[model samples]
Target: MGSRVEEVPNKQVILKDYSSGFQKESDLLVKSGSIKLKVPEESSNAVVLVKNLYLSCDPAMGVLMRGVPVPGFIYPYKPGSPIYGYGVAKVIDSRHPNFKKGDLVWGMTAWEEYTLIPKPESLIKIEHTDIPLSYYTGLLGMAGLTAYAGYFEVSSPKKGERVFVSAASEAVGQLVGQFAKLLGCYVVGSAGSKEKVDLLKNRLGFDEAFDYKEEPDLEVRIDVYFDNVGGKMLDAVLLNMRIRGRITACGMISQYNLQQPEGVHNLMNIILRQIRMGGFTADNYLHLYPKFLEKLLPHIRKGEIIYIEDVARGLENGPRALMGLFSGRNFGKQLVEVACE
Candidate 1:
């Protein structure tokens, strides 16, 4: 059975252009329309109707807005269409055997207030709602999975090892530091601002944190770097890494905005120090998501883990919230709260 394409209210972020360099909020224009409440007229296929509840603003979103499909990567947002990122949503209606009405899910979604997900395979149904729903957009979603995968799978950390994180106050960065501490490592973090440095130390339980902006020689300031920002910080960290150290490249936030990306100065160190370096995308560890929960959920429930989020008010603020990431304006995990059931 198919329902008529119902008229409904919707808000969305429209791509203004390819985003030449550092993104300005104007690069993403918020547009509203009377979107059809029902799925498209293409055909009768399994799909789910959802009212967007939460949208995440992340560093990688910058690349997605350009609509550039890098080799071996998914396509980006196209111009004149709504932008989609990671989000937590509620199923309003479903034609898929795997989904039904009122099921909460988190995965890839649009920056719109209402969406009809044509491909539900990308979305993961939420079985646990005991934690905050917004967490699905950050700590409990890709961010959490990234920290877990990067640390445990890629970095191959051992207890009492020295660990440091760049962008340490952001979603994944914060959790990586916490995970390191739980492993009994001497954990430190670097953030752009002093306040974030304090939060990383006082609230997140990092052993030490420093404002990277204030430090002239990050290479000398820290012994190890988790390498999130990944431009100059990565170069600096390379010089400072311990013998046979590990570098898990989770993201390259520092270069996202640059007209020309910064070059790493210390590549020779990798060969000399025998450091093990690797990069990971969350999807690679999707199979391990369940195992991750087995390890992570308990820590979260027992108050051994913590996460922080900087929530913007509505879909209209999506552009600003996203641009703020480059400027390091967001205090914690940046996300936009659209609406909930």
Candidate 2:
């Protein structure tokens, strides 16, 4: 006879209420819950039971915290339920054919110890274990794809192009800067603090980096702009864009927490400079994942590309780590380590 599957307690980071203005740590509550170890018979055969290991903390999550409806197909998190985000997990049980027990995966998951993913299509199986498993939450996950698509596909970067990245120390921005460097572009990045600026220039290999808070004037004109921190920084970059510049609007982190988003004054420069600006989501570029991996994996293996992560241990600290992103408190890619594999 086969052994019976057991039910276990699940610790979850629950959203207490919808955010109004800026989000506070108080908006989230870590609570204990319980779940069956096996997928229910009535559940969809596609469902997979995952034991989450790491959870990503992104600025975009703040937008979901707000009760307001968002443009596009994004659904807001329910106030009383566990918040969901990109995460790395181990498959505990699977009714799906593509995955089986003990397979590592990364995708949209609840901020809980265990999650039953209804649609397993979004989950990508982790084939390479040579790199840190946590990277699937950042570098090897959505953030990396965002940088690849934004830089290569959207901006259509060319060698010798002068490139600029805003919020260059963050997950996607860091990768974008590295990608530009690898492309032989003169890359300059703007960071929030001296430490982050140093990381961009000294560690991440940006040709030049500056603390935007200290130097609000983006002194030089550039041919490409990878915008992660939008708002005044974006407004400043607008005035400095060289003619025919390409701007990939990857994110607007600065505006996420604002009650009223800041308006840009230099939008007219787009017309005067004949600049091209476009926004993208990683989901739109998933078709290129295999191609992206083929390119990125070699760089990673050869030490041509490096990634940094700031890990917050335990699910209880998840809220604080998430809130830290807005305050520039997290040093690198902020993630919560829920369990060890």
Candidate 3:
């Protein structure tokens, strides 16, 4: 006559309010509440139970947490709710037939131990178990797809071309740089710190890497550009790009927090050089997932491809990990490891 399932304490990171600029730890709080082991009949209409494994804290999350609206783009996070971001998780129960218990998946997950994901269609089911599970949070996930679709599909990369990626040591940037190199192109990347620059060059095998904070003349720095960082970096990259070069606007981490974003000043060169640029988001190429994974997985297993990640423990670290992305504190795919399976 009564529910027999034990109530679990949901330790969740709740956003106190929307952030205007840089977020502080005070912006989020970890509190415990109640959740039933089984979804109620009323709740089972759409809900799927997920135990989050690795929660990705991306540069874009900084923009998402600020609650800003950009036309025709993904909307920002709402205030007083559990912050949702990409994660590698296991579906423990499901109302949707597409998912079932023990299925590993990656998609928008809450910053907590467990989540009730409503839309299962957006989630990608994990099939391979040979690779490290963390890969699903970055290299084998949205960041990897962004690099594949944006650079290869949209920009139409060719062998021997020169490629540049901004924030090169970060998750998406690191993969983009490597993808270009694997295609027999010269790859260069820019980072905010010297350590990241070194990682890009020495560790990730990028052809060249620069610390943008130390370089005052980025225009002169990039002789051939494959621009990822936008805003003023786009302006500088434009001036340096080779004739007829293309740029993929993957993200604009440097400008996310600015109230008035810096503008690109070298638009004229694009016309003069016949340079082409395309802006891309992951959803644009969701159809290409299987193809992209087919091409990328072998490289990953062989160690021909590598990723960088900065992981923080506990859901309480969500704000710090998310905020650190803008300042270049996170070395790679910034994710909060809520649980391990």
Output the number of the lDDT-best candidate: 2
Task: Tell me the tens digit of each residue's lDDT in model 3 across 1-341.
Answer: 37587678788888888875766667787878777766566775667888889988776666666776643234676787887778899987788888889999988888878788877778889998898888888898888888888778878788887777887888888888898888888887888888888899899998888888788476443323545567877877777877777777777776776888897778999898887877778877889999998998899889999888888987777778877877777887888888778
Candidate 1 or 3, higher lDDT?
1
Clashes of 3: 1
Candidate 3 error regions (>4 Å): 1-3, 70-75, 219-224
lDDT of 1 by residue, 148-228 (tens): 989888888888888889889999999999999998889888898889988998999998888988994854433345778
Each candidate structure's TM-score, on Cα atoms with residue i matched to residue i, is 0.95, 0.97, 0.94
lDDT of 2 by residue, 111-184 (tens): 99999999998899999999899999999998999899999999989999999999898989999999999999
Candidate 3 accuracy as TM-score: 0.94
State, as a TM-score between 0 and 1, how close model 2 is to the true structure: 0.97
Clashing pairs in 3: 308-332
**lDDT of candidate 3?**
0.79
lDDT of each: 0.84, 0.91, 0.79
